[model samples]
Target: MSDVGRDIRLVGRDLPVGAAAESYRALVSELKAAADVLGAVITSHKVAVVRAADDLIDSLDPVAVECGEVNALRREGTFLRGFARDPMSVGRVVDEIWPRGEHVVCLGAGGSAIALGRHLLSRPEPPSLVFADRSAAAAAHLESVLASRTGVRSDGSGSVEAASAVVHVGPGPWDELVAGSPPGTLVVNATGLGKDRPGSPLSAEADFPRDAVLWELNYRGDLALLRQAERQGVERHDGWQLFCHGWAAALGPILDLPDEAATARRFAELAAPLRPRTGGQ
Candidate 1:
């Protein structure tokens, strides 16, 4: 393939109120004008916009691949931290609920949630995946794309088959879905309300069945759900683990590198410049 036409691109789509679509819409021209745009992945912090851009890019069928097949690699704040955790524990959860217990629910629509949903789609039996976001239209669009390759639904309920499933839960700064899960259920919290921000999906004091595992995708203290889970005597997973787990998956394709392990090595080398600059993490 010729390198001349190989470039990563982002398209702007209309957004819901409070989202920064206008700003991103303006950047499209500037991004397209820049040199060395090829091989670079376009990213957006907003989940809906990312999905829109992803749809646009897929329509163009660019040669460049997405990072972990995700349009953006967000930091471990609220949404990303949530996505990072699913892959970390999903395998173990799948093993526990194997053959029949292969349903996974993501509580939001963001880079992290998309990454986890994609990861689960690659597994054996391909756990039924669902995308429960406040934006019903965005959830439908993303769910459609996810189900295109895997036999899944995002509606959360219906057709319990060996496919991914999605559910659109409107206006949730709530956790009714996660709290209602049965034992050994794999529930991932992919929202940003309880990160450095206050207000968790469900009450920190809510009683989660012993068989269910609650993991929050935040890395810092004073605002992390991990701490809240601890205080509530709930078993929780950490955000950094999600970061590490998803990193291998996301970086590989974005970097045009080999397998997850090789991509990790290359990224470690690239990050060497930051070790002394940031004093290493």
Candidate 2:
């Protein structure tokens, strides 16, 4: 907001994942009732919030509908609107680093993973996806969503060429999966472990794929996964770019700002100084 010269006050609301529908409904009702409140940018509870308060929202953008999540909320003259800007935000960061035809292994089957899958499948030549989550339900949900969008199937075959697959992993220690990825694959830690929770998706013993790009989707926190990537001498990306792009995409609708690359770049430049410093910064 400071980048756009808007004097908006940002507030933080930390809601646990899978909170009851009433909790989200109350929050949405409060926001709608508050005339001074502009809107909000959701983080971990994107999908949960949307599921809980679907009927309360006056409108939802196409992406929100498709992804079953809402990362941005806006109020428009007595109407409450929801938008899932993660695809746009994730696309910007992925396009810069992702090599065409390289496999993608996302460690979480949450909102960000779904967004990444959706963006990748939209490409003319979609890269094969491997989504792993501790929760069978979450992995199945991601598979179902992707299957509806593209005719991809998950048959436990683990065939990157024929179909994408969702693997239900145990808690921690994904050494075999991480080490077995093809060279130059894009390995992502979409699980909120490093940020929202403590710890990393991969154990310290895990070895990253050769020439792979490791993307840890957390700008701040312990960020053990990022440190592991660095220790292994692989090219790594943090979530700072995604964070900036997400805010820019959300604020574009809330503040009526221009949606263009230049604007997003300027926003990133302005936000750079405020980014949290991790180890060896």
Using lDDT as the measure, the top candidate is 2
State model 1's lDDT.
0.47
Best by TM-score: 2
Off by over 4 Å in 1: 1-19, 36-101, 128-131, 149-168, 221-224, 245-255, 262-281
Q: How accurate locally, in lDDT, is each candidate?
A: 0.47, 0.81
Clash count list over all predictions: 19, 0
lDDT per residue (tens digit) for residues 1-281 in model 1: 21213343444444343555555444433344444433223322544433334433322212113312333333221112102223333343333333245555566776566556665676644766656787765566556546655653444455455564656767764455656666656566666655535665655555555565555555443444445556656655545444433455444344443455444455455654543221111
lDDT of 2: 0.81
In Å, residue 209's CA in model 2 sits off its true spot by 1.4
lDDT of 2 by residue, 1-281 (tens): 46665788888887776688898989999888889988887866888888788988999999898788998889876689999988988988889877475588899999899999998887766777887889877777787778865664443466533445555656755777778989998888999888888898888888888898888889899999988888988888888888778878877778777764567788778777897875422
Tell me the TM-score of each prediction against the true structure. 0.60, 0.90
Candidate no. 1 TM-score = 0.60
